[model samples]
Target chain A: MTLSADGSRAGRSPRRGLSMRAGRRLWLAIFLAPAVVLFAAFVTYPILSALAYSLYSWEGIGRSGFAGVGNFIRLFTTFPYPRLLANAFGNNVIVFVLTMLVQNLTGLGLALLLARNPWGARAYRAIFFLPVTLSLVIVGFLWALFLNPVFGVVNKTLGIVGLGALARPWLGEPGIALVTLTLINAWRWLGFPTIVFLAGINAVPEDYLEAARLDGASEWDVTRRIIFPLLAPAVTIIVILTFIGSFNWFELPYVVQGVSGAPNRATDVLGLLFYRTAFGEVDTGLQDIGVGSAIAVLMFIMLVTVSTVGAVFLRRREVEMG
Target chain B: MRRLCTAMIAVALLATFFPASVLGQEPAKLSFWSWRTEDKWVYDRMIRLFQQRNPGIKIEFIPFRAPEYATILSTGLTAGRGPDIIHLRAYGGLETFAAPGFIAPLDFEQVPELKRFPLQTIAGARSRKDGRIYGVPFATQTLVIFYNKKIFAQHNLTVPKTWEQFITVMRTLKDKGVVPLANGGKEGWTLEVLSGVIAPNFYGGTTFFEAVTRGQTTFRESAYTGALAKMLELRPYMPTGFMGVDYATMQQMFINEQAAMFIGGSWEIGFFKAQNKNLDFGVFPGPTERADQIPWVSSYADGNYGINAKTANMEAALKFIRFTATLEFGQMFTDLLAQMSAVPGVVVKNPQLQQVQAMNRKATPYIMLVGFRWQAPTGSTLLQSALQGMMAGTLTPAQVGEEVTRGLSSWVDAFRGR
Candidate 1:
């Protein structure tokens, strides 16, 4: 027997290597098949189809003909569409900004409080996270009733507190409707970030605090300079997820304000616009799937670009802190 | 075990190949779909009546939410997997289905009762492109002011006959701390209906509608803007914080007797009675600008029943749709639904429904729906938003006119010249 490379016999080496390669190939295929198939079917296929559909004029489900960039042009130049598209995009930006601000501050504050392991800390955590578990439909519908001008509990509570002067229609005013919707959305999702931040705080090593204390650092100083920086990963996740959620928001607003985002389109969002365009308005009963697809493609590009850039920036910060 | 499995497979294959006719046991079932979920019980009663007359066919009535119905129906029809019979919306709503041949076309020969309906009424179910009637016209909804009889009696206010008297009545109601109008700005469609009740009286009704359609005038004309201005004049008499009030709330206000009047469709009669058995209300044509002016209400054909083009049970579907066109179905609809039936010669026994029919005689087409719903940037959409802005104090009446004119001008050649 002749040794090959190391101590293996030359005759046996070729057969063993060949079988090992074949076995590894089979195992790789087995492991990757489901994920690859799913990604192609759900992700790649939809994106490509939407891109293709955007370039054509569609009458309901039937493709009328290729229109090149006609659909996109219509979105930008059409009398009401340009106005609607801008309003929706601007509302999404507002939703993202307000949601991020409200979630982070409240979440971080709650996390810090719970980090002390106060009496019934687990119960408090459960209470804070409870809203996240409720169905968005129920939450939206309940909130709509609560905010009603005459019968709503919100206005009733204000009356009881003698703040009756401030009891205006929360969702009826065009100026404040989008803001009201965002705050409701924030209330629904506040629990998720609070739990994430709490976990991050708990994972902080106790020895670091002890060392900081030994050096005569105040609790506030230790938290500001130490624990805060260590929670970077959690913040990154919460921020990115909130951004995506805000842009893709549909159900809660749809349930509360409807597809028109009533009160003169005050609460219109990209998602609602997409749906109205695709399915036709309840009153007019005319649908333009080509324009709807165009809106979808634009939204997708925006989401992907912003999210990727944000993740890279956040991940870099995480690495720096680590 | 292998022999048992083989035997089971053989039985299943044989069952699939055996026709119901061969078995001479089961009736042929035809599925029906509609957006009138609220009317499902009534439809079930109607379907039972049809089943009694025709024992060999069983019909299934399925209803979906109004907002989701169009999408659901389109998706099902596209996949060649929808119901055999369909309840379709009229005008542009019917055209979307009919233009693509998703609905089977009907002829006067197939259903001779189609000749009973006037051309204008039949136009609602006719395909704009193909010029073929595709469905049986079902009902007509007229816009009118519904007044709480008790409140009007308490205030000694008979229905006003002119614009000046109407304002005086509203003012009196406001002074008495009653919401004069139960309408709101929260829902654009409700606002459109509110406009429909008030606008035509100022804009010369069918005459102006014809002129605009013929490209002789546009929405920017004073007659149209003046009508919008009239709507603004009633802002003070509307419910408190009316901008936040929705259709349900508006209905609640009227039903609860918090508001004295409601501008809504005639279809509200059934809903009002159902919600509040003790409620007493009466309908009136919207007051005119002058005592002599025609009190023109906006009216349109509401919906229709059609056969799905790809139905396997075509014979049964046609039979049922024909039943819908008969005077019997029309009377049942008018009595149960409390709206005007499109079927001619059907006596409306209900007093409230009779009043709606009387008011509809002076009706102009619900202009936006009849003339402008065929294309994108629809006139209804433009008018709704404009009216909302006007109510919100963001836009003046002329601006509302201009906005609507601008939107319609994009597709309407009549407005394009200016």
Candidate 2:
């Protein structure tokens, strides 16, 4: 009797109140619907499908039979899986480390130089940002030709300078192939971080830098203490993005190396290894898609773990600088 | 509210199921996707001819360039939206497409001309374990040693008949400041021309390849290592920085007369003739060790067309396959693409093609190198890496052999587990 009285009391209120609440809810649903649907359809569905597939022995076709954890186990005991994974992971780490170091150092240095109001600073920024616009495929093919040991301009120029001895086959030698690939990647991606840092630096309040100067802080001291701290968010973003990009690096090595990650598979990364495993080779039989999916899942897990750890560390360092 | 929910559910179900029902009433139009954009004109003409021959059939030709094709095909296949017909290259992952039964096996009676295709080429299209032909072999290509006639004439060197003579010619050419052979190891497959094809002859001959395939001999014990040793031996004769030169640039070097010989496939005949019409070049077998042992040529189906197993218009698909296999269609396609036709008795009128045709006929049965076969997904990569390592002095021949053996064994194990 008390609940009925409460319900009647609520129902007797103005219809406008209920309609208003309903309208608000409708707007909220409308605003969130597109993104929710897109996320579910593309990202979530594919991930779930891949996870499901990792447990099967299908070749990406017909009936998929359940293999349970057989695919994962094969990663350890199967032919050269251990060695291939180690080589690929090792190469990926090397690429990630080198790309991060080079991109950060070069990008920050360029940002600092541009912040000094040098002549044609805008033009310099434009020039530095140009390569990032190019597709990695184009970048890779361009560099492949540019670094050609026989007739490439690099070697020809070196030969002209009487330093012919210095010009080795950059992409051919196993020791240097990975380094060369890293350098190419850095060159292509340097523009993005530089632009990001430049934006961050521009947002730095001038008064703080002036106060630092007035306090007898040298230019280096001002940059080190003030500008650097202020730019932490940008640095965090760049590092995280670079790390992910390096881990997923596929096109440059694939196009330049022609899918073999050549020079003794010196350039092999997990991306290439995954592709070969799924596709099989001329002498070997075709791969099971189930195993390929399992490898992909493992790669995803690794990426997520690394990204999480990186986010935690970087987020902790990001503090608002007055 | 209940009525609204029921109505919405009805609409959703109708929307989803309507198209499939509608599809059943219409003539199925199949889409044929291919990566051979270079042969677009030829395919277009062939498709036109096919449509005319089969009035009820329709084929939409979708072409893609490299890398993109792989991505697009993978996406389509995964989404169950792949084309009915797909043209596959020799090297990329054919096994992946075939093993899962994504591709339909060609009906032999519908396309009996396939019987005329080389046995090795047909064998390449079959699953190693099941021996089911999943692709229709349409074309074949082989890598032969092309010698600069002018260089040979100037040096008074007969096309070296034996390996010893070949080495002697190289020494003579080296003495004259000309690189003996222009090979690009940068992309790595250039090394295969030496290792996969030429080296087998030096190691164990035809028996060696058979043994490797049968698992009687691993890649390590086979003549492949000897081939690597031989490649290392000739490293001194190759142009400095040859490691960075790609196939095109290497061919360019030969065309410019900067190099004496180019080891490459017959596909280059068209490009070479276009660049220098007057350039005198002759195709010769790779030098051999024994006098009685004829030089074996390496060849495989360049690309094969296969039907998607999910395709609805099986009859139309079979008609298209039959149309392409006809001698007239085969000749026209080959003539336009400047490739050797898989159809027997299809005479190529072009002189350059005639030469290739003659070579194809006279050469010992072409050996299907594992590099071209769909065996291990990573086999080519492994071999390419080992070769690159050997060339860079970072790996020994023994190590190269061991690495390949280990990689292949692991690949085999992975598949077996699956």
Task: Give the number of the best model, judged by DockQ.
Answer: 1
Query: Interface RMSD of candidate 2?
Result: 4.0
Q: Which candidate is the best by TM-score?
A: 1
Off by over 4 Å in 1: A1-14, A17-21, A320-322, B1-26
Model 1: per-residue Cα lDDT over B1-418, one tens digit each: 9999999999999988996677788888999999999999999999999999899999999999988999999889988999999999888888888887789999988898999998878989988787999999998889999988899899999899998999999999899888899898887899999988899998999999999888888889999998889998998998767887888999998999889999999889999999999999898888997787769999988888999999988988889989999999999988888878899988987777788888877889998988778766778877887788899888899998898888887768767759
Stretches of candidate 2 exceeding 4 Å from the true structure: A1-22, A60-63, A279-288, B1-30, B49-60, B68-71, B88-95, B106-108, B114-121, B128-132, B348-378, B411-418
> Candidate 2: what lDDT?
0.75
Q: Please provide, for model 2 over A6-32, each residue's C-alpha lDDT reduced to its tens digit, 9 standing for 90 to 100.
A: 476555555756777889999999999
Interface RMSD of 1: 1.6
Each model's TM-score for chain A is 0.93, 0.90
Considering every candidate listed, which one attains the maximal lDDT? 1
True contacts kept of each: 0.49, 0.62
What lDDT does candidate 1 reach at residue B258? 88
